[model samples]
Target chain A: MAGSDGSNGSKEKSNDFANELPSYNAENMQSNMKVIYYSRTFMSIIGGVIAGILGFTGLMGFVFYFLVMAITSAGIAAKAGFSVHLYFDSWNLIILDGFLGGLMSFVLFWTFAYDIVHIF
Target chain B: MAEDLVLDTAIRDWVLIPLSVVMVLIGVLRHFVSKLMRTSSQLPDPKIVKEGQVIIRARNLRAAANFIPLKSFRARKVYYSNEENGLLFVPKGQAQNAQAQMFSDPNMAMDMMKKNLSMIIPQTLTFAWVNFFFSGFVAAKIPFPLTQRFRSMLQNGIDLSTVDVSYVSSRSWYFLNLFGLRGLFSLILGEENATDDTQRMMQMGGFGFDPSKSLSAEKDGLDILQHEWALPKFEQRAETVLRKLVS
Candidate 1:
């Protein structure tokens, strides 16, 4: 209902502000989670390739490094939105992905070593 | 003694062949397992802006300058490297503002710096990757035996004057070409260039946009010369235009 006194401008401004809030927040949250997810996945593959090249030495050093980087990157991504839940979720995903990546590398390297030693 | 040596060689070959097969099998199996279990997700939109948004507004600046819109405007800042005498573009926005103010507050500044740095990391990495790959290709094309020995000797310890210029010439051309581009960027952003490469680039861009002086906000009304043409049969035409721009 239009006010007779023409207070409509202020009311419209307030309503516009209210409407803008949710979308902006939503967009930021979505983008942050998206980046965190992608970073974890990409970093995992890079970690795998590195692990393959360097073997046990990579396992001891670089694997842990990848984990740390993934986790930190995830945190940075999550903080971009100021969303607590998104931040927590991103952190969880990063840490889990990192551990899995490390485990995978460990198994791969071990199997490779075994195969090489036994094949001869 | 000959018979003993033959037997030793036979044993080594037998062992190595089987080992190589087993290693391949193990590697493939591990790859499958990792593929099955690994969880990956898409990266969030870099809260930072993308490079396409940067205002690299010079026609034929790289190649096919005509295709690039003259009216097209994008916001960017040019970062000049004193040591390399190079320029890199940064997107314009609140991000650049935050970066310019980094030293005032260490904690806040560092956080902002990290985000801005991350955005450009991909570009620099791509550049490095291409440079190294190109260098490797050039290195591999040298004729073998004599050339290989020559290369190795040069690598081990050779004076710059003693090395073949052909090996260095092509790459240096590439360097100068890109340097001209950086110079164009400096001109566009109205930054003064204290580097020789930027000066040469400015001379080539037809702007005579002196890096020594403050770049004017008004368009210099000159064409740019791209050193390489991605399109077919256009190289000569492009070179002609480039020559005119520099001349």
Candidate 2:
């Protein structure tokens, strides 16, 4: 969804009158959302486990999660041939949503793993 | 006000490990079961397909309307909105009739039923099994401290008031793993696996019942769309863009 406006701007500037601006495909958008949602969930869980094992807690844990999330997003962007800007209009939204969405799972796994490793 | 408590290592090995393992195994099994149960999408009739194509074309025209000159835009708009010969225009109430036909489509109904069955049966079985075999035993302790309010929710079967709120019972642990194991499923089965608990919960929340609801919604959207000629403003917008680029 990023760079869509840029793409539209360029399309308008181009002299090809017959060239159609790509319309938003709802089905394609839904599938992309599913991919990002699940992938972010998966990454957050793993990241939480790692953070817990490293004994990160409170604010540090949140910071570590964001770091991991950035790497995951970069990896996804690379896989998509640097088209993240095309697929996602706002990187901030993705990060914010991923952080909030995965908080519960992260906390659950992090607490359990932390206790099992350190307390026992 | 509180006493220090110690949980045996044996509980970790016997209870926690086994519960986690069983939960993961069940999740993997459910993934495969749902995959096997998935029915391929049925193709609509040829007439329906043709009608869909017309709608798509009209949509594309609307999206690219600014690209064409105003005269051409008007011509295309007349071609679509013309009462007598428009390729995309339908008779009054035809949209409603199409939605009604889609609503009663047996294939759609069957697909919804299959999805519901796949989601419900495994969840029921897992809950029953956990309750029957592992109920009343505390499985694992949460690492962080919790207030006394969580004691009843986390320690479901155990009646010990002295027990720490962090010590969760087997049933609660099972439920936790139910939602927490999504990452494991994604790792093992890939991102789009059918066993996603969140997706199932969303479905259960009534979003997944009727496919025709969305279809009708799209139809309504199309019906209400006005044929605004974007080409008239295209020149002005292009001039501003050029000015900005030069600046």
Candidate 3:
């Protein structure tokens, strides 16, 4: 009721917008942030433990974490029918944010595992 | 140089492995519990949904305005910028009133409270249980060296001055496992499983309460959107691209 005349305006604008950006779909663009957060956390912890088992320390440990993350991302991509492009595009939140977001968890687990396995 | 203390294999079997397993089990349990606790969000009013769609359509037009023909771009610009007929031209102060109403909505407040309770209850219980059963004992040592600055953080609950900073108490180990067990949960529960502490922490930090922020942002964006058409130069750009291809 506020924009009775404007409703027609919206119809026109919506058509123009649709024609221009045919690739962008709001429903398809929606990524589950909760899932991405959990998966990234899991991957980073696993990566950290692996790095710890490999006896990596300091900056080398972080480098190892990224390596493991890349492998994990590749595995996820493969699991999604090898449509790496589509998966990365749709799930960019996880693919991009997951890299640095899990660093703290990686370091924590890596250092903990290193201590338990090698030192103590 | 710090000295290395050789811990027996019995400590690994009795303390370290059990602690790790317990942490993972708790994480899996928390995931299922939280999932059970989660309630679906209530749908917004149809009026609000229509308003949101109008703003979204305007934004989409702005982004893709360059691709359309000049006449089409101008039509959208005219429609959006007309004070009487513009999709976003609401009655003065109406947006502010709606925003205020949303900010004070009690249902939103209740949702936030419920989420906080879910995260806090599990976390507090886990912390208390770990501290009660596992306090006072040095369970494991960190392989790396640290300065005296980390003595308080790494050696929590242990009051001994002679104990190495590398030696972590059981409570600290539990804390470490709490933060680091996301991957094991993922392996067992699959991706996006609800048991992640990091996500809960992020939610607690107010990252989850974005509806109001986004609504306000949408209003601001529509208010400021410059409808300057980009399609007038499209033919020129297309010719240049074709020329480059031919060359």
Question: What is the alpha-carbon lDDT of model 2 when measured against the actual structure?
Answer: 0.67
> Residue-wise lDDT of candidate 3 within A10-120, one digit each (tens)?
122233334443444344334323444555677677677788898886668767877877766665545545643343345565457667768767877787678667865
**Model 2 alpha-carbon miss at residue B165, Å:** 2.0
Error of 1 at A103 (Å): 3.5
Could you say which candidate leads in TM-score? Answer: 2
Quote each prediction's TM-score: 0.20, 0.70, 0.66
lDDT, candidate 1, residue B49? Answer: 25
Clashing pairs in 3: A35-B192, A42-B182, A42-B183
lDDT of each: 0.34, 0.67, 0.64
- Tens-digit lDDT string for candidate 2 (A1-120): 221221211111334443343434555555556566666777778777887788775677778777877876776566555644455555663455555677667877776677577655
Clashes of 2: 7
Q: Lowest-scoring 10 consecutive residues by lDDT in candidate 3 chain A?
A: A1-10
Residue pairs of candidate 2 with colliding backbone atoms: A1-A86, A1-A87, A1-A88, A1-A89, A2-A85, A2-A88, A2-A89
Shift of residue B173 alpha carbon in model 1, Å: 50
How big is the positional error of residue B91 in model 1, measured in Å on the Cα after superposition? 59
Among residues 3 or more apart in sequence or in different chains, the pairs in candidate 1 whose N, CA or C atoms overlap within 3 Å are: A34-B43, A34-B44, A35-B43, A35-B44, A37-B41, A38-B41, A38-B42, A38-B43, A119-B19, B60-B65
Positional deviation of residue A107's Cα in model 1 after best superposition, in angstroms: 3.9
**Native contacts retained per candidate?**
0.00, 0.29, 0.47
| For model 3 chain B, the run of ten residues with the poorest summed lDDT | B204-213
Q: What DockQ does predicted model 2 obtain?
A: 0.31
